[model samples]
Target chain A: MPGWYYDKKELRHSPSAQDGIDYKTEMRYRKEGARLIINTGSKMDLGYNTMATGVVYYHRFYMFHSFKQFPRYVTACCCLFLAGKVEETPKKCKDIIKTAKSLLTDQKFTTFGEDPKEEVMTLERILLQTIKFDLQVEHPYQYLLKYAKCLKGDKQKLQKMVQMAWTFVNDSLCTTLALQWEPEIIAVALMYLAGKLSKFEVVDWMGRNTKHCRWWDMFVEDVTMDLLEDICHQVLDLYSQSDAPIHPDSPPLHSNAKQQMPSLRPSNGQEKTLSPDRPPSVNAKGPPLSDVPQFPYQTFTGAPPPAAAYASVFPSSMAGPPGGPPPHLSGPPPHIAAPPPAVFSYVNHPPPFSTVVPPGAPPYFPANAPPPGQPPQHRPYYPPQ
Target chain B: MSFEKSHTYEALNRIGRGAYGTVYKAKDKKTGNDVALKRVCVPLSEDGIPMNTLREISLLRQLNTHDHPNIVRLLDVCHGQQMERELIMYLVFEHVEQDLSTYIERHSKGFSGVQIRSLSREILNGVDFLHSNRIVHRDLKPQNLLVTHDGHIKLADFGLAKTYDFEMKLTSVVVTLWYRAPEVLLGLTYATPVDIWSIGCIIVELYSLKPLFCGESDGDQLSKIFRVLGKPPESEWPEENISIKWNSFNVNSQISIDRICPNICETAYDLIMSMLTFNPKRRITALEALNHRFFLEEPINT
Candidate 1:
């Protein structure tokens, strides 16, 4: 099986970041994209496995290609379409597209382009290539249930714990933990979190106890407290952010300096509407751009005038290159004939790796290169400095 | 992001037409290796990629990771040119000189007793590997088994294969009818045993130099099987097979294995009969067949 895991540092400088998208904005895009897949899949009556697989595919796809290059919603739908087939619950691309159309607002749906069916079908090929055709994905849900069965606890409490962990696994799809750890480790960590939350302790696990034996050790050997706590915190972090009600009119509070330091402001009004909590009010009017305060450092092109920053970030047309003619289409659609070339120039001119990497950091790329014999294209696109 | 298919692989000649697409003998430009490229044309429909194509690719990709010697190697999978209405996918496999059918035909005097024993063991080893991995090669026949120049067998043609666990009622229209199992003919649910039944038919063909149960239709296929193994006991008849009546087949007595394959030893006859058992539950598995006395009685030539 192909190893899909990457460390924290690798994720910090993801392909989306290389394409000039800030890390926080890229994460927001992922959360919204995952939500889109889940909602559309549920609307189409697809099972959780299919939807989860789609989200994993969406996450893995962005690791190689930029979220800016391919619209997240279109890729989400294509992922779900491909996931349905992979999970043996095949759904027609038209049905998924139709469901997506109903779920997305008029402005957001426009990102799918003129012919949504053709757009998704073309991206389906790209999605397959990006994922290296490693279609089989193992999820934490099965491990959660299997471990629950082995733990001796009150029946109702165990059931509740399992249910909570299952939800955690679902929410974890919105994070990059799936790309950083195996499903088995995720399952154990979530179960540990659920146990603490539900106040259920596994005093007996039907296994002999060694000195200082942890419950997780029975399932996965050498699972350090730090690793388990880290996975739990990642899932817990989602809840911490989701606790605050995100009103359509209010700006997201970048309370932490760490968040504000790396993330660019939402490039356009369309992206501002991608808040998961306000999907139905996607077209709800927000404060005018003039009224919103400008942060000088929020511009990705460092120290530029705020007006020049906004001009460089905003595309003249949303349905241009990012959503424009698919590679297979023989002729460029008339609407895509004149694309804003400046928007994507940064894709080829990423900042130096040293600028992003802390000093004394271990070498990441050479050790983590894809196994030899994989097609050259499968290698992650590390932009030239 | 895939490399241009034409640039990566240079087609040497057309191999043959398979169930899903055309096969070609090709050479890999990067590695300078001979390869067989199976080109599957996926129509650009509203449904997107076909489920079978996806399943086949995913399953083969997973299975190839094990690098089992008895199974064909899937070196690479790349997309070809996309036409107006269809997308082409090329599955690059390591090229083998000939299939078992060609191998059997080339040796006009039929396989020696030892050769049959070795080939049967290799075939069982491949089937056992698949079954252990929860995969069933739904289409198993002489033509699907590739024989290297060194007399090794590699199971191929996974177009109809599926990863089966418990009771998976797959499409009944699988496997060549001549090698199909009785449960499948009777429209009953099947699992890995179906492959075992195909292997049995193949074992008989190795001796007879022809298909053991050559039936033109589903019913005829069952009749031919019953004619040899005898109509299964009424108690053994599956309740799911309501269409096929118990009294339909006129077969009253089972034919002796010695009469059908006179040259085979007692151990070989026993193993083949065990595989050909009417009831799938009663039929021997690939793993069990590998451990049978037939293989232990003689030393196979390396």
Candidate 2:
């Protein structure tokens, strides 16, 4: 089986770096992308495991392909969509897109293009191929819970420490720690950090002995202090910085777009200046927005142009009616125009939306027919992306 | 990490058809090795890949890390040409010549005592490895057991296997009815004990050359089991199985195993009885079955 881990040198020379994205700029894009996946998954009522898996998928996908090749937001949505099914919490593509639209500001939502569903569905195939269909991802949360059970300490303090460690693991998803280390090592290191921060020492664990001076020794052999602190510092770095600025030199969006692109990196010292105490943009919350220009409907055919060259690929007709039906719903793309294969036709037979039908209404409503008193309109048809 | 593309393997012949897709005997052009290419057609619906297929591939990949001898090897997974709306995925596996069912069918004469002992021991070893790894092969009929040219057994077709920790409320309808355990037939929750029940039925089939308790339906399967093993006392019947009443089974006396399969020795009979116990709690585990007296005793000539 192919492994997911990469060494420090391999990660430093990642595909994105090879595509002309500086390491710091690529890291900024990763943090924002991970945050998007976690936020989207939480809003959809998915568990932490599903969200972490999605983030891991995002990180791994960028390793094989450059961030310049694919838009971070679109890839984030596709990752979460695939993770939901892999984790056994299935959600419709339209529902996920709907939640994303509600969460994102109108400016950022433009990246989803005219048909958000088609964009995400199309990217799903590339995500699966890039990951090589190795769907199992072991996260640190399970190990943190398992190790906490073995420690003998004050119940409340232990619970608090474990909770802090769990949050650290969640934040660690933004970094490349997942690509660099196994879940066991990461779990042990985070638990040590939590214990130090909470002032709770594991003096009496289940298998405490003279040889096992440190609690982690009982779980994993030969864990050096240097390794644990290095892991802890990576997670701590997330809190030390307020936010990173988006690249200003990139092409500007439409004038009416609501999103406010922040000034370029402080080193550049060109373009509009950012206020020292400027209030954070609510449309794009969380980590500072990265410099990469968002490519809404850019196709991944051949060697994609670098991030600086993305202006040429931007669709000219992006300013469409906000919440109206898609312009091309009447004539879908030729590939999905045909009826779905009969193998899984039963799944499509039921009415698509669960919220539309009133209680005690007929269960066998024709998919094409609207409910009583409802106007006849095109219910958004989702063809295979 | 580049994967071997689908074009590298030349199709030789069609071997089998499954609910997922067809399996073909293919040859690697570069290495000159025979491989089994299982074609899985994934419908590109709103939901990208099927959940069951994802789980199956995930579980198999994890298990493949150990490289157990009795488990079939998943050599590679590569994408083929994408059809109009369906994606073709080929799971390349090490090919085996025959399955256990065909192997049993080819031997018109009864198997030697030594042959039966070796084959049964190999089967139990495979089951024990899976159980130790916290995986349950939900479907374990003869067709799923591949037989190599040298008569080695390699467990294959893990489409229904799952990695379980505690008592999971798994799908109620699993396993072929002929090899299904009573707990599954009665709709009661089950775990690894279900596999042991199937092994017990298989051990008897090794001697009788046919299924022990063959039935047409779930209820009929339980009836057939009761007729042979005799109905258990009301207290032993699981309280959770409300659909199956103790009185529904009219078996008044238990049939002797020797009458059903007289060719087996005394120790073999004892081992089979322990494996076919009515209660899953009392059913012989794979490890325990491996250490039974039948395996320890001298082989009796047929």
Candidate 3:
């Protein structure tokens, strides 16, 4: 089984070509799919955590699969179905499918077959493989109350800040912030964003001294104001894209962040309508077969079918790497593409301790330096500047 | 695409049915080590994969990170094509010879107090690990407790374990009725202490060589419990605390531990009593039970 914890280094990823979908395309489908979850999940009476978890699964699923091959709405339904189970509030598959089909008013949402259940199950197995059975997803909501209690601000202001931050955390799920940042970082970012909205001096609320550190410092040791601000901007970007209020300095949010996102904003009180502009072009040619056809089913068996048949079921571009799916799809797979260009020191993969060791340092001097076999040492200690 | 080549486990024989799938005793062809392969049959439906499967996987991953001997290790997870359409998910775990129930049935003559103490200590250790990590092993019964050939015990079957949340209104009816606590029977909000109650029941059952409360139904199960512990007082469990309407019942007296299992020592009786207390708050915690005089009375080495 693949390990769950990744520390900026050794986070696995396969190139977008391997999955036959570009990163942006996959992200768009994931966003739309997550929106479908919110639309359908509201009817099923799922909690916010379940919605957040379902969205995380959607984002994580695309890290391995291509949206072009696996129909976005079906995959979204599968994610919610799985999320419902993971969050311990299970719903029947038929009910989820019915609700999803009803919400996906657009004809483009391909019906894999007369009954979408089988296709959803097929996708469910792939979903499990993509996640490597590492099903536990830590959400920022779990930390919101704790952070709120620690803020040394006015009672009423703290309450309002918590509410704002809570909404920000939900909206952040709409963006790729959950995938890009740690849950604690998102929580801290939302808190800061909430404070800014309320005009509360949150930066030094926990006291400036290191001994009496900010609540974020207690949870995330290496977190800085810049990273928190960046996360806040990512969340704010989601709000701007939707009809919701955006922070003053942030650019206008993308159009995709429309009102349909129930988890992101307060209900707009408008009748729910699926946009007709999005056409069902992806599967317009294929017959709607509820059960996988015999040849495709055989391809799913252990025997490797010819590339052509396998490609039909799983497009060549979407084919998994020659080996089993890599452990964590946090960065590009080592073989195919270069790791995503490093952003922050902690963003993609941390540089090895040896690489961080300054020009004239002794070969084996750094106490915490890797003993050579470790190529990607995540805990790179920058010696006192 | 194929997980088969990487995960090859040859089936030895079928075990019993698991919570949501078929279990088999298999040999890991790679390491030639015997292991239990639970073929979790995730039905082909819109519901996606079963949440129980996910919870078991997630909780086992967290619990077995450091490899505690008392908790079953999730050795591997692999997918197999079952039938033509259905997908079979195999959760590979360390194979144990028998469960606690089977072990007790085989050794019906009796287990020494020392053996019983060791078993209780091991179960408590597993429970403590789970509770400390804020997980509640909602189902803790003899059937879910696996025992190795060398008498080592481990808690298995985490289909119902979950990260504990206080305000979250989880379903009341979770654990098997026989091991269910009074508060659970009354449909009250529960926590880790509910597990301790089940442990108390198991301790009594282990000592007696039979189930402590073997009721055919939920109502009967509660009656059996009240028969043994006496009808619980209404004051401790207020009307507002539980959802169930209070049923007026009468019992002459609470059955003494001596009458139930006279062979067990006084310390063991006291520990069981502390655990079986009606008030969940008053119930002995897993850690406290570990320190009880019953464990100290007989050194595990003996």
Candidate closest to the true structure, highest lDDT: 1
Q: After superposition, how far is residue B59 of candidate 2 from its true place, in Å?
A: 2.8
- DockQ score, prediction 2: 0.45
lDDT ranking, best first: 1, 2, 3
Candidate 2 docking class:
acceptable
Screening candidate 2 with a backbone cut-off below 3 angstroms (N, C-alpha, C), the clashing residue pairs are A247-A291
Assess chain B of each prediction and give its TM-score.
0.87, 0.86, 0.84
Q: lDDT of all the models against the reference? A: 0.69, 0.68, 0.62
lDDT of 1 at B236: 87
Best by DockQ: 2
Of the pair 2 and 3, which is ahead by TM-score? 2
Q: C-alpha displacement of B120 in model 1, angstroms?
A: 1.2
Highest TM-score, which number?
1
Clashes of each: 0, 1, 9
Across residues A288-377, which tens digit of lDDT does each residue of candidate 2 receive? 333222321111111112221211111111111111112132233334322221121111221211111233554322432244455323
Residue pairs that clash (backbone atoms under 3 angstroms), model 3: A12-A328, A12-A329, A13-A333, A19-A318, A20-A317, A93-B47, A108-A280, A113-A290, A241-A253
lDDT for each residue of candidate 1 in B134-157, tens digit (9 for 90 to 100) = 878877999889999999999987
lDDT of predicted model 3: 0.62
